[model samples]
Target: MRLMIVAALTLVCVAPAVAQDFTAAPNYGDVRLAPGFSPDPHLVVVQAGGSIDVDGTLSNCSGFITSAPDLRLFWDGNGSLDLKVSAISNADTTLVISGPNGAWYCDDDGGDGSNPSVTLSSVSGQYDIWVGTFDDGETRSAVLSISELSSF
Candidate 1:
């Protein structure tokens, strides 16, 4: 009984260290978009980085982000074209997205310069996105762009 109690306490203490909850409300607002929506590249200004560390939390996910998502995107369209989600900033940035299929995708330096971009082959549902800095505890201004044609 003592061993079981200790084990349960251990699990509770360590759980938050590796958790990144995408179900929380976004820090920025949410956006709904369909394929070929006018204003091809939807953009939003965001502050990248947060208190939550993402290293080793999920496969290919890095950098630090808030407990809630920076942006939640509702994609109402077919998978004819790929969806491109990216961040543009002077500071080195990273991208973490939770797709509707419950898959987590991440990217670092996949865009121009030190920015990050993730192109989703499957594109049709809610995507909780987080823009983060490569370094810990560093928050910077960035532009989050969603497009099917190109990445920023």
Candidate 2:
């Protein structure tokens, strides 16, 4: 009887450790722009009829420098959406949207380079977007905004 109790307690203690919560922020990595990329990589999961707000800065220079149009957002899925940023130099930033099947419903490539927004009518699961870098020989950075109306 004592052995059974100890085993149960051991399982209870270790179970939670194996189940990690990615939404806690620390689990997510920095949104970094690849070589010649702008905004970098940003990913999240949202439910149907949900929406996400995105606002950030980008540039060839290091650190958070907001000049105007620095990063761009692109969506490759049907139910997905994006808020893209552009500069006077017309820097190229590729934001690819991809996720699991069936869950990939809607999307939007947020353009205008200013402040952009997107609403998901019906979609779920994990989605990813890669921010490209401008060809100014400077590094680019971007801040991500996300919201989930449904269960993660």
Candidate 3:
């Protein structure tokens, strides 16, 4: 919560200088969201199951499911983003979040059930979010949500 507040303040302080263009903020990151991408966050749901290779960088994630899709989030340095995911039907779900910085944060059981969540504070950029399952053959339904907690 404190981080969100700080992020909010940061956004407020910077809002006056921000340009009206929707392009990625200068020096924020290498990723500029594709054209027509929505700046507002939305709740997304996708199907997950089967298997995908796991990288060693993520310590706790099982792996991205075969048919599961990735969600692209574009942040224009406005404020903070709280990324959350839930495996509504299956309790064995895990999450993998990869930012433009090439870092991945993995989590399991952080949500209401066995869901996962990651928070981005004071950073304006894009991220690739993946939902994975614990077991190779396990399949389930999951919901992905991102919140722009504050825009100044």
Query: All predictions: root-mean-square deviation over Cα?
Result: 1.7, 15.9, 15.9
For candidate 3, write residues 94-122 as lDDT tens digits: 66666657676666666666566666553
Q: List lDDT for all candidates, in order.
A: 0.88, 0.29, 0.53
Ranking, TM-score, top scorer first: 1, 3, 2
For model 1, the local distance difference test gives: 0.88
Best by lDDT: 1
Error of 3 at 30 (Å): 17
List model 2 lDDT by residue over 1-152, tens digit each: 99999999998876622111222332123342222233232333211110111122211111111122122222333444332221211333222232334221112224445322343332334444323332332433333343222111
lDDT at residue 23 of model 2 (Cα atoms): 25
Clash pairs, model 3 backbone: none
Counting clashing residue pairs in each candidate, in order, gives: 0, 28, 0
What is the alpha-carbon RMSD of candidate 3 to the true structure? 15.9
Q: Which ten-residue region of model 2 has the weakest summed lDDT?
A: 46-55
